[model samples]
Target: MIFTSERLVVKTITEAHKKEFVELLTAEEIITAIPQQRPSEEDINVKFEKAIGFDGDISKNPLNIFGVFEEGEDELIGLVAFLTNDDGDRELGYRFRKPYWGKGYATEITKRMIDYSFSELKLDKITADVWVENVASNKVLSKFLKPTKEFYNEYDNCTDRRYTLLKEDWN
Candidate 1:
């Protein structure tokens, strides 16, 4: 496992998880919140490839995607990613299955990820972006990251907000 919280285990995605990962990405609620994860088969395949390719060393391969499973459960309940943006900042992103929403999993795992990013990875800063309409995600992010700005996201055709957390600012 890459990391674990009290009730969840975040680990590198593998071929065995390709099916669950695809289902999580294709859920209607997830698509509604983040339209970027289109349901097309090709896009799903590409995402699966990217996820399984993560080698657990973000410095060498900055694009890392991991499956989030409940403790002692084999099924993947969600996925989280840490990737280097164009500006070379480590950006955090996550999505959970519909059933997993409202269960405090996002906040719990996100807090752990933030701590890991700072302590283990030793990143200078971690950034995230969320659609303004995604209230839950915005709330989760606000708990650990300071809001930087809001702007129109042409690619997603919606207003989005950016947030960042510096290592020095972490508790």
Candidate 2:
């Protein structure tokens, strides 16, 4: 799937986009935004390749991650995506290269994802978990979703704040 805003182009990942994904994902500064540490290029390649493969069969792809790009650029500046939880619910997530921080790209991409989730996917709810200390990310989440809960997440080994946006309330 592809989504176009006035200044951004969000689309499903593809094999040709591997190089750019690696660059943004492996940056030391960028890596801090999420739970994962700096990953080897091979690890990124494997994961990105899987996402790209799923992009071809979105109906079967549980992890619906998208590659976000600026309108005039070929580089990957950020990502807007969701992962299926064990309960079969979607958990929203977003991240961007450190250089792109403070440019409002996170907010822009997230708003688009929320719109797509409610309007295109017809989702009843989209949940999110953000590191309790990630003030930057929380600001974006707060703008579009309501804080619902908080807990310690073993996967990230950090306290997480949960947020959710329901389709009926979003519109």
Highest TM-score model number: 1
In candidate 2, what are the lDDT values of residues 1-171, reduced to their tens digit?
Answer: 478776889887667777767867777676676655778768777778776766454435677677888897777777766777655778878788777889988888888888877777778899888888888989999999999888887876788888888888986
How far does residue 7 in candidate 2 sit from its true spot (Å)?
A: 1.2
lDDT of 2 at 117: 78
Q: Identify the runs in model 2 with alpha carbons over 4 angstroms from their true place.
A: 40-42, 55-59
**Estimated TM-score for each candidate:** 0.93, 0.88
Please tell me which predicted candidate would have the highest lDDT against the true structure: 1
Off by over 4 Å in 1: 37-39
Report the CA-based lDDT of candidate 1 relative to the real structure.
0.86
lDDT of 1 by residue, 32-101 (tens): 8875546689878887998887765876667778899999998889999888765688889888988899
Candidate 2, after superposition: displacement of residue 36 in Å? 2.3
Q: Ten residues in a row with the worst lDDT in model 2?
A: 53-62
Per-candidate RMSD, Å: 1.5, 2.0
Q: Where does the lowest 10-residue lDDT sum fall in candidate 1?
A: 54-63
